[model samples]
Target: MTAFDAAAEFDRQVRTLLDRGHPEAAGLTAAEFGALLAPLRETVTERGGAAVAVAPEEGRVPFVLVVTREVVPVERAVALTTLAGRTKPGVVDRHFADGDLIRFTPTKEVELPDAHAYVLFDVERGEEFCGAVPEDAMAAIADRGRTPLTIEEGIALVTQYPAALAKNKCFSLGGSRCGDRRVPAIWISQNAPKLGWCWAGNPHSWLGMASAAGRAAAGT
Candidate 1:
């Protein structure tokens, strides 16, 4: 899609949130806000991606749009050790340090009950985990071979395993110089680093791995 199309879609998503009684999206009606998002739309389109809007369930924070990069197959297990310096220590680190091979299997193409979630496989342990999934559903999802994940599915995966993904180096931390304090920044491009919600200065904010990966994928 073109940048303008992305921006229009983003605007529609934001409007939907507002219609759903999300107070945080009130500010989005401003013209200045639209201007600010113009470049973001362009970035997302350039990277062959789309934008997904995430709203906090608490209705406290503003609705944010995350950009999704192009979908690419990760056929082989990516060694966690390779991400040492690029990523901070986390679940992936601990597992890799223990000599475990990490595999992220996409379940987007499968017609499963919970197609929205991605399956994270610990190859050594033969264990699989998905975020916000009930214990009963895990078995069913696992039975379905991990399918290819779309950019949106990848975002959902990040949302499900924020700490684990960040620690494993799936996402990097991004920061901007906010006066004397260097505060964590949001992702705008695929080449840029990703940050968890914990780094956004407002821990309560819901901008997590999903947003970060989405931003990076969009090459903002």
Candidate 2:
């Protein structure tokens, strides 16, 4: 799609969020959500098609509207998520919810702006890295100058584009790691999207690491 088309697509995503009542889920009204995105919309329109242009050549996710934990906790975000055409809401793995022991903080390389709502650009599903170890995939992604997706970003991804989390095409959220070997991921479970984790050193043919070119406040 052309740059203008990409921008239009971005707008459509924003509308999708509103249509899904995500703003209400986050305790914000539609007007409030619109107000929050006003500046980002200006920036995106001004750039024309720069957002899509910078994406990876394949499986590029042009943009995603992310509502951070500050606005809605991860657990709540997971509950709000749903697979396409399915009424069953997405879920957080019981393991992840166990005592809240897994603190999936963003890796040092993935810097996010200090805003409850922002946009991630040029994301990729990392299908080429399928069956590669999460740790190794992270290194390869960095070598390519891309940053991995955090749990929040991963949720935002499938939240906006549920089809991206297909049966074997699921992705790992390498950007968020606990202080251990666990690498968080999102996949299909019982026909619904699920937030789970895998060992950092392990590899899964169905799961590839997810990454993004960068993140920025929408208004920026």
Candidate 3:
């Protein structure tokens, strides 16, 4: 949990995306995707701190490479994510099988860079809000001057640190909304990852609202 090689970590993330066929989904080759991300290396190196993914209360900040839905559809990205040697692809809940039907865009408060991809820093698991309603947790997050994690950001966290999506500690993506009460969330299922949604007004003892200090688009 000490400071890590920022550049190296960024490289590893790029490889993860490539390995998971992100570029292919986006109609680009691995090399092309690499080229697309090359400009962000310097920003990552300059902004990255201790290589940790848990909330800052744990004493270390975290950063992740985020490819927006524009680059690779959320459903595709989820299916590409894996748990170590597992061959099972992540699943999207039946409710959202038609990904196109859900326009789960980032909330107004979550200002992502204009680019297709970016980096999120100071990530938090939001365990402190476990058992709190998503709507309430969001207000608390805003009160503290923090931004909630969007679906893309949440996926990026687990895509980089699978262990972060643990049992009884999964988080809600309050930063993304579909004009209804459903709040997206990522959690472990059958040893693989799953993208699902829960009611915004409801509270779960195991689900907390994940958050970030801020984000920066790649190449900016």
lDDT of 1: 0.27
TM-score of 1: 0.24
| Residue pairs that clash (backbone atoms under 3 angstroms), model 2 | 40-218, 40-219
Q: In model 3, which regions exceed 4 Å deviation?
A: 48-61, 97-101
List model 1 lDDT by residue over 1-87, tens digit each. Answer: 322343454456434323332222223344443343344444433444222332222211112342221211111111111221243
Q: Relative to the true structure, how large is the alpha-carbon lDDT of every model?
A: 0.27, 0.80, 0.80
- How many backbone clashes does every candidate have? 7, 2, 1
TM-score per model over all chains = 0.24, 0.90, 0.89
Ranking by TM-score: 2, 3, 1
Quickly count the clashes in candidate 1.
7
Q: Tell me, by TM-score, which candidate is best.
A: 2
lDDT of 3 by residue, 1-220 (tens): 6645677778888888887788998899888888888887877777634533233233124677888888888887888876645677888877775654358998777788854887887788898888999999999999988899988888888777776777788889999998888999987789788889999999999998998878777655
RMSD, one per candidate, in order = 17.2, 2.4, 2.9
TM-score for candidate 3, please give it.
0.89
